[model samples]
Target: MAMESTPNIVGVDLFCGAGGLTHGLVRGGINVKAGVDLDPSCRYPFEENNEAVFLERDVNDLSPEALAPYLEQGDFSLLAGCAPCQPFSSYSQSGRSKKRGMDWQLVSNFGRLVQGLQPDLVTMENVSQLAGHKVFEDFLGYLKGYTVRWSVVECIKVGIPQSRRRLVLLASKLGAQGLELEYDPAVPARTVRDEIENLPPIAAGEQHSQDPLHIACSLSEMNLKRIKASKPGGTWRDWDPELVAPCHRKESGSTYPSVYGRMEWDVPAPTITTQCFGYGNGRFGHPVQDRAISLREAAMLQTFPQSYKFAPDDETIRFNRLGRLIGNAVPVRLGEVIGKTLVNHVRMTQGEIAVPSPAHHGRLF
Candidate 1:
C-alpha cells in the first residue's frame, strides 16, 4: 500500500488500542496526529500501523496542555474516546461484576477530557447495552451543548465482516449531524471463508511464516481433545458423560452452551470473544478448517485491515488483553462512515468539501 495522505481534520484518539479507528479515519483522507492510552504495550503496533504518534499515558490525566502538542491551532480538532467497558458486559451479570474492576466512571472520565480539550467534535463506541445505563445518560447530558446523535447500531450495516452490534455516538459543536448507514445483501456479507479461505492453512497453535498476525495461540491438551469432540455450531450436548464436565451435570453448566462450540462457515461468527483463539472457548472453531481462525482473520472480522501489525511476541498475545482490543474496537468501516459524515457536515456548514450522503445512492437499492 502507498503512503498517500491528505491534510484535513487532524484528530486525536483517546484510548486508541492498536489504531483501529485511526486507521479508518486515515482511509477516509483525514490525518490522525496521535493516539493516547495507558498501556505501553499498545505503542509498537499503534505507532507502526497508523500515521499517528502513540502516547502511552492515561486519558484520565490528560489536560489541555498535555493534548496541545498533538493539536494544530487552525486545523479542525476532534476528540474521540472509547472507554473500557468490562463492567457493563453481559458476563458481568454474575458475581463477575465484583471481581472485574470495570470502572463505571470512565464515561465521565471521557466527559472531563472533552470538556478540557473542547475539541470541535466528539465521538465514542461501546456495547449496545450501554444505551440504557445511567452512566451513558450522564455522558449524554454532559454533551448537551453539542449537536448529539447516538444509536444502538449493528456493525454489519456498515460493511464490517462481523455481526457485532454496538452503541455509536457522534457529537459535534458545529451543527446538527447524523449518519444514514447503507448496507446491501447483494454486496455479500463477509464470512470467515471470505476473509481467510485464500490464506495457506496452518495447524492449531501455529503462526504463518509470511504473516505474523496470521498466528494462533496454543490450546491445552485437554482443550484440544474437547475441541476435536465438538462440532461446528454444536454444543457439548453431543459429548459423552465422561467427556462432559461434572459441572455440566450440575445446573450451573446448562447456560454455558456457547463454550466449546464451532462456528458455521456460511454464517457470521458469533461475536469473537477474547478466547476466540482457543477452539474450545466459544463458537471460534473454524467450521471446516479444523483449526480456529488465525489472529489475522479475527482482527479482519473486527474490521482491521489485513495489513494490521500486532504486538510483538506470543507473550504479548494474551487472550484477554488482545481480545479486549479486538472485541471492543469501533469497526473501522463504522469509523469511516463517521469520518465521511463529519467531512460532509463540515463541508456543508463550513465550506470544506462537498460529498454525497447514502440517500444519493438510492439508485443502488
Candidate 2:
C-alpha cells in the first residue's frame, strides 16, 4: 500500500482552507497531491503542513484540465471539494441578507468540475442546510451515475469536541465498492476538557509568552464582569441584570441566548464560528478562565492539532483572518474517517480485505 512510486490513492482538495481535510487525509494514508484555495493566507499552512501544492486560483476560473497536472494517476483518484457554504448555512436562511448570490454558485461549479473529471472517488462537506437547496439537489442529481451516500453529521457524534454540524457526501463510480460514508463514532463524544484541558492556563486578557497561539483575546473591563457572571452551560439569562447587554433587553434579542455563554468542561464546546475568539460572539468563553478561548483552543475544537501552524513566524496574528481560517475548517477527525473509509472501500474492492475487517474500521457497504 506504499505510495512512494505507484501511489495507492492521490487526492486534490478543492477549497482546501488551511489543509485541515488534507491533513486528515494524509493521516488516513492518502497522498494529497494538491490543495486549491483563493486565500493566499492559506498557501503557507496548506503547503507547509500537508506538503501538497497549493493553487491560489479561484475554483470558478479553473477546470479539471487545469487541475490534472497536480493529481497523479493512482489506484484511486479522489476529488474532495467543500465550497464556501455560508450562503446555504442555516444562519443565512434565517435572515433577509440570506443569499450573497456570489459564493453559492461555487457549489454548482464544484458539480461542474466533478462532472468534467469524474474521479474514482468524490467527497464533499458543507453546512447541513445545504441539503435543502437546489444547488445541492442538482449536484446529487449530477452524480446519479455513481454510488452515493450523504447525511447530516453532528460533529460531536463523530468524536469531534465541538457541537458543529455538517453534511458529508461520498460518491464513487466503483458501484458497491465505493466507500459508504459513516458519521457515527464508535466511541463516546469527546468533551472540551478531553481536547484542551491540558494546555497551560492564561488569564482573560493575556497571551502566553511561551506559546503565541495560546494567547487569548483581550476583554474590556465591562465584558470581564459579564463573563464573570456567566455560568458554564448557562446562557446570558443567568447573568446579573446589570451585566446584561442592552441588546438582550430588546424583544428580538431575547431569543439569542446562546451568545455570551461559557462552555461546560464535560461537554463539547459550542460550534467555533469565525467570531469564536470574541467572548461575546458565541458560547466561546473558557469554563474557568475569564476569557474567550484562545486561537489555539479554537483550532483544536475544529480538530486541528495544537501544534498546527497557521501563519509564518514573522506574520502578525490578525484575529479576524486566523479566526476565519480556524472556524471554517473541516474537522480533521471527520476527514480522517472519510479517508479511512475510502481506503477500506478500495481494499475491499481489491479483495485485499473482507467485510468484518473493514467493519472494524468503520461502517462498510
Q: Per-model C-alpha lDDT, please? A: 0.70, 0.81
Q: What's the number of clashes in each of the models?
A: 0, 0
**Reference-based TM-score of each model:** 0.85, 0.91
* Pairs of residues at least 3 apart in sequence or in different chains that clash in candidate 1: none
Stretches of candidate 2 exceeding 4 Å from the true structure: 1-7, 89-103, 182-186, 357-365
Residue-wise lDDT of candidate 2 within 260-292, one digit each (tens)?
A: 889999999888888889998989999998999
| Alpha carbon deviation, residue 83, candidate 2 (Å) | 1.1
- Residue 138 of model 1, lDDT score: 82
Top TM-score hit: 2
What is the C-alpha lDDT profile of model 1 across 51-137, one tens digit per residue? 778987766566777887676643677877567665654223221222335667556778877777778778787788888778888
Score candidate 2 by TM-score against the native: 0.91
